[model samples]
Target: MTSQTFGVQDLTLTSVSGSNVDSMTQLHDSYDLAGLTLPNRVVMAPMTRVRSNPEGLATASTATYYAQRASAGLIVSEGVHPHVEGQSNPLTPGLATDEQAASWVQVTDAVHNHGGRIFAQLMHGGRVGHPDNTGGLQPVGPSAVAAPGRGFTPKGPQDFPTPRALSGDEVVEHAASYGEAAARGIGAGFDGVELHGANGYLIAQFLSSNANLRTDSYGGSIENRVRFAVEATAGAVEKVGGHRVGIRLSPDSGIWGVEETESRELYLALLEQLSPLGLAYVHLEATTDDDTLLALRKAWDGTLIMNPARPGGPTPAGPEDARRWLDNGADLISFGRAFIANPDLVERLRDGLPLAEADPATFYAGGDRGYIDYPTYRA
Candidate 1:
């Protein structure tokens, strides 16, 4: 089933009018992904809290943290490194171990108990890590180059180390690792899995010309560069079902010195190939939602999910912004910071109520004081 003929069966899309703020109340109010029905369209984007056990497993706090956000129609869990060497921070958890995989079971159970669907986001922060963080294992990427900035190591902030460019065989190994992680995510009872290909991580490193200097099948031309990501995603879908998968892409992102002269070609070809996978959706993060991406949305032929840029830095837009995307043909809008501060974001948006401000200080700290302590509107 190519994206060209990708069927949209009874997809409940809400109507939106410029003058009517309530028009968005029905957008994707009733949509099914792989047999699971969503109550609404708002999705909680994956965020990194860097809070995990020393052995790199999710703790009880993690489960409680996610359960609080179960009100969202869908939840994309925090980034989980698929491989040990792929670990970005010691505090960041992984699904590589039996315990690590088992720990996430509580999280999925919590979400499902509250009628929420959650997807574990599999991320591999390639050159964006250091040996100090990975038990002396060398960070790997498409090229043996260092990113242009520092990363938070266990000791403290240090320069981003030059990564070992992955051999063709290693690329396959990592892709397989993604598949294994997806399988583990399924075992943990997640509704689905998402490939974290954005934010200059492993996949982004391969996509960017500045980071990927390889001249082989995984580099040079846009097609070759995107091949790694497509293949990785293919492996993930193969392990877990296609309907149980999603991919996040950050085209033209310069984070960590990632740059692409022909991002349009790279992503277009990537999406064109991925369209047939029957994946849940394509998650895109662009500075300003551009028409080129919107054109890709048409080409994608599946549900298109967008992460809008927040004016005040990482804040999720209000109902008006979500409505704007719906009016422009977006299938779903993902909220980051707003979801963090407001657990009942859907009700707040629906009733036109004021939102609570997120305290930036405790965004990543480990404690229930800020994690699940945000109060809902009493009025």
Candidate 2:
């Protein structure tokens, strides 16, 4: 692997990949999502890097880091915890503080100044969190069940913490937190907001029966389980408007011990419920097979953004993968690892250029050496 961050070598690789694309320029052209025009279809998917201030606020480093990738058509920021109990790790950032909200202002300004748009991804860790990470605050979830695997604590990996089962009033409290966080996101000057209802988080936990044993209005049947996500979306929409909000779902994914009995039935029902909301878009994980993804596309009437889960590689092959989604009814494609290696990925894809190899070691490390140092195509 080349130690050099960015240069002609990276561009050369992008050219190699670009040649496989059907139409480089057309692929690089702009598109619209929820009436917001994106300069191109290259979206930077939300990535977690345990970089935050001691108080869980977004620091200057976080702002600088995201600003470096402002060339993306749309940059979805890392999961920002809506509530204090939502904190999954000590390193995760939060939007609960005025300081954190204030710090994100620079990030928005940087991206906007560079002609890029951004959205904040709101996440509630639920059962995924540990009391050690949240100042001894009990992790809240739909039930008291613990996840199947170990979680990272400040010292090291520890058993999954037993979460406090939320009551009717607590559920409402969490929803209110989501609404307040969405408002904070807009206050931070984000172009829009994305609700992280995927990856076995709080919302997804509620949607899965294995995690939620509640018999109340918030649990049991698919409709009852999916109510939390629907309400969470409603909360965000109420704060930022439906047009400025998006929701991500991993219907078939069993991530972090979230077990859905009837995956298809539950997700389709959720989609049907969300259909009337007129959301900005529905982002599904790339793990969904072609058949399943196609079904979702048909069910959802709004913009569909698919994350192509590339095996053995962090980033998907841009043009070809994007074309696949486009052909399958996806209006946009989100790239996670690709944006890490190529800051000017859109330009490279447009020019039929090679992509720069990403350094996995620096993916979560706090430094400009890997974050902002990625080079763009010089020619």
Candidate 3:
């Protein structure tokens, strides 16, 4: 049966505000995203595991971690640094060097072997990085402003430093670097790459009116502020074709002190440029209001993945939450913290099994205890 025939069902969404779409999506259905046919509408949301070694390479444990959760329709790997300066947190993985890219072969191979698809999330920390975490190398951003928060370090959380402002030429190069990372990710056996343009990182920093205090062509105006993010995505599209690229965005999420006064206008302009690229999909977090999000959904023509739960909300995104979003025009639903302890999350959700609770202590302590020891459901 087609999506139009949700006939005689109690589950129905009459319409969403600010958008013309009067349709609803089902969770267990398949979707044609760009060219790849996803088996289900459940995407494994990317979370920062920080399980890599000091050399910025993924471990065999990392391979096992993702392989166990391969039942999801699509897996978006944790934030991966495209370059040294972009490394957001300590002990995170990278796709910067040839060696680093090679290190992920096991991860991609394992996921593919388990009949799963995976994408690498290219993230740049910008002013959020501490020199202590990046081997004394100062971070860089669109402006010299420092984010108003602490950054993770070996000693403990330290104050974020003022990043060196990038010149116009460097900004262009940094934007193009997404293409280089996309090539490496593809070569490393990933199905595609997702540009991490949200959660107050480099792209978000550039988009923020405060973080990106530049008078140049890359700042101030809405179009100018979105230039860096657009260039970054376009670069990836140029290198790996539009079908192989996706981007994650959290409009109006003031994480790490990045703020947008006119989020709706800014994102609409950003999406206008991105739509012509024919991206595989656009993953959006529910940072902004329903009206703004629905408006964005209408503006974007391709597949839309929605993380319905608010960031850092007390409760995780649950089945009910998924149903609500699916009914409201989201093509796919993502679960972040819910996927942590429940490796077989897809099966559990499909079969109506209970989920396991995750240990917060061992989340980033860098051990196998909470990372891979979570067992699947039992009768």
| Top of the candidates by lDDT | 3
Model 3: number of backbone collisions: 0
Give per-residue CA lDDT, model 1, range 1-379, as digits (tens): 0011111122233433344434444544766765768788888889888788878888888887788788788899989998888998768888877789998998899888987889999999999999998889989988899988799888888998889989989998987888899999999998888998988899888888888999888889888888888898999999988999999987776777888767777788899889889999888775434766676777788877877663236544555556667666677888887777878777666555567767777876766766788877753
* Residue lDDT tens for model 3, 306-351: 9998878877787767777776778899999878888988877776
Q: What are the runs in model 2 whose C-alpha is more than 4 Å off?
A: 2-26, 310-317
Per-candidate alpha-carbon RMSD to the true structure: 6.6, 4.2, 4.6
Q: Alpha-carbon error at 137 in model 1, in Å?
A: 1.4
- Candidate 1's C-alpha runs over 4 A off are 1-28, 310-315
> How high is the CA lDDT of each candidate model?
0.80, 0.80, 0.87
Whole-model lDDT, candidate 1?
0.80
Top model number, TM-score: 3
Q: Rank the models by lDDT, top first.
A: 3, 2, 1
| Clash counts for all predictions | 1, 7, 0
Error of 1 at 244 (Å): 0.2
lDDT of 2: 0.80
Tell me the tens digit of each residue's lDDT in model 2 across 275-356: 8888999988865566777788899999887887742354454555666565566777888877878777777666666677
lDDT of 1 at 375: 76
* Model 3 residue 343 distance off true place after TM-score fit, in angstroms: 0.6
